[model samples]
Target: MASVALSGKVAVVTGSGGGIGRAVAIAMAEAGASVVINDVGASLHGEGASGSPANETKALIEATGGRAAINTDSVAEWDGAQKIVQCALDNFSRIDIVVNNAGILRDSIFHKMDPNDWRAVIDVHLHGTFNVSRAAAEHFRRQESGAYVHMTSGSGLAGMVGQANYSAAKLGITALSKVIALDMGRYNVRSNCIAPIAWSRMTSSIPEDSPEKKALVEKLKRMTPDKNAPLAVYLASDAARHVNAQIFGVRLHEIYLMGQSRMLRSVHRSEGWTPESIAEHAMPALQGSFMSVQSSSQLIPWDPI
Candidate 1:
C-alpha cells in the first residue's frame, strides 16, 4: 500500500495558532514536514492580537519532536504575507505547501450590514488569502512544486442567513483558488479549497440550547479537526499531485466532492427574439431547472454532518 507522508517537505499554515489551522499545521508536522505556524492571534472578529497562539502551537509541535516555527504576521497585508513566506525559506530552506486558513466573521443581514463590517471580513478572508498566495507564488515557482489548501465555508457555497460579509468573502476564496490552480498548474503547483464543518472558536456562536446546535455538537464529537486534517494533508502530498482546481467539504463522517456553477438549461432562436418571445420560450424551457431560493439552513435542516 502507498503511504501519504510529507517527509523533507516544508509547509506554512496561516492562522494556525488554533482551531482548524492549528490542527492542520500539527498534522503537517506529524507527517514529517517542517512547519511555519503563522497566526496573528486575532479575536474571532479580527480584533487585537497576541503572540501566544502561534507560540503555543509551535510549542505543541516541538513537544512532539517536530520541527516548527512561529510567525505573528498578519496575512491581510502584502508585506506581512511576504515575511511569513520568507520565514519558511529562512528556517526550513524551502517551501512546499501553504494552507490559507486565516479568517474572521462579521455576520449581518445584508440590508442592515455595515459597510465597515463588509470591508473587514473581505480584507481578512478574501484579500488575506490572496496576499499569502501571492507571497508564496514566486518561491513555489522557483522550486517547481507547491500545493495550496484554501479554507472556504458553507456560508459561501450554500448560503446562510446573517453572514453576508462572511459568505461573500468565502465564496470569493473558492473562485480565487480555482484561478490559482489554473495559472500555476503548468508549473506543478496545485490549489484546492475545502469547506469544513467543525466545532471550533468560529463555530462557538451557535445558540447553546437550540436543537440544531445540540445535534451539531453531537456530530462534531466524531468529526473533529483532527479528522479534517487528513484531507488537507493528502492534498499537500505528492499522492494527490493531479488533484487540482477542485472544491471539497469535510463533514462528520463524509467527504464531499462539491459541484460548481454551470448552465443548467438554455434556449436558442434562429433569429433574435423580442423580450416577450424569450420570456415565453426561455422561461418555459428552464422552469424545470429553476431552483428554490432556500438558505443553507433550509436545505440541510440538520446538524453539521
Candidate 2:
C-alpha cells in the first residue's frame, strides 16, 4: 500500500489552524494531496480572527515538502464558503476532498442557553457544514469524484448535559451527511461522518466540577487529535471508494462502525385501543430495547485502548 493514498488530489480542511483540524490538514498533505488550510482564525468560542495560525499550519506543511495554501473565509457564510472552494481551484486546479472540521463550543444548560449562543453554534457547525459541502457539490458532480468527511461528535450522537446547541448541530451534521450521500451518490461523490474522541481545546473546555468528570478528562488526554487523522485520510482516499453514508467512531486504536437508526424490534396491533392499552402493550415490548440516558464516557467507560 502507498502512503500517498491521495496523490494527485486536492483537499480543503476547514479550521486547519490547530487541534484536530490542524492534525487532519497535515495528514491530508502527507498523503500527497494539495491541501487548502481553511481557517477563519476564530477562537474556540467563535470570536476574533487572525492569519498567523493558518500561516503556521501552511508553513508546517511546506516544511515537510507538502503542498498547501491558506484560505481565511468563514465557512458559516454562503459567499465565503464559495471563496474557500474557489481557493482550492485557484491553487491546485481542482478539489477532490473536503473535511468539514470547523466548529466552536457554545455550551449551556438547555434553559440557560441564550438564543444567541444557539444561533452562533448552529451557524458554524450546521450551516457551516452545509455551506461548504454545498459549494463543493457542484465541482464534485461535474468531476464525478469527491469525498466529504464531516466532523460529528459523541456529545450529539450520545448525549451531554450542557451542550444543547452543540449537540443539535453535531447530530444535524450526521443527518446532513446522510442526505448528501443519498443525493450525490449518482455523481460518484461520497459523504460520511466521523464521531471522533480526542483531547483537544474543545474537550478542554469541559468543566471538571465532579470527580467522575475530572477522571474522564484525564483519560481523554491519552487520546490525541492525530489518532483521528488517519481515519479522515483513509476515508478521503481512493482505498475507501466503496464506503458511503457511514458513521465511524475513533478512540485511540479502536475504530467502530457506529450503528445508524435501525429498528431493533417492532410490534403491531390488529386494532388500536386507548392510551391505557398502549401503556400495557407497547411499554413492555419497547422497554427491553430502550437505551440508557448515558453520556459518551459513561457508555465507553474503560480507558481507551
The positional error of residue 268 in candidate 1, measured at the CA in angstroms, is: 1.2
Q: What are the per-residue Cα lDDT tens digits for candidate 1 across 1-305?
A: 55679999999999999999999999999999999999999999989999999988999999999999888998889999999999999998899999999988888888999999999999989999999999999888887899999999888998888899999899999999999999999899999999988888788776669886687666666667776799999999999998999999888767989889888887888897898997889788879999777775466555543
Return the top candidate by TM-score: 2
Off by over 4 Å in 2: 2-4
lDDT score, residue 108, model 2?
Answer: 84
Quantify all predictions' global Cα lDDT against the true fold.
Answer: 0.89, 0.93
lDDT of 2 by residue, 1-305 (tens): 74438889999999999989999999999989999999988889999999999999999999999999999999999999999999999999999999999999988889999999999999999999999999999999999999999999988898798989999999999999999999999999999999998899899987899997798888889999999999999999988889999999999899998888888887778886678877999888889999888976677766776
RMSD of each: 1.7, 1.2
TM-score of each: 0.95, 0.97
Number of backbone-clashing residue pairs for each candidate, in the order shown: 0, 0
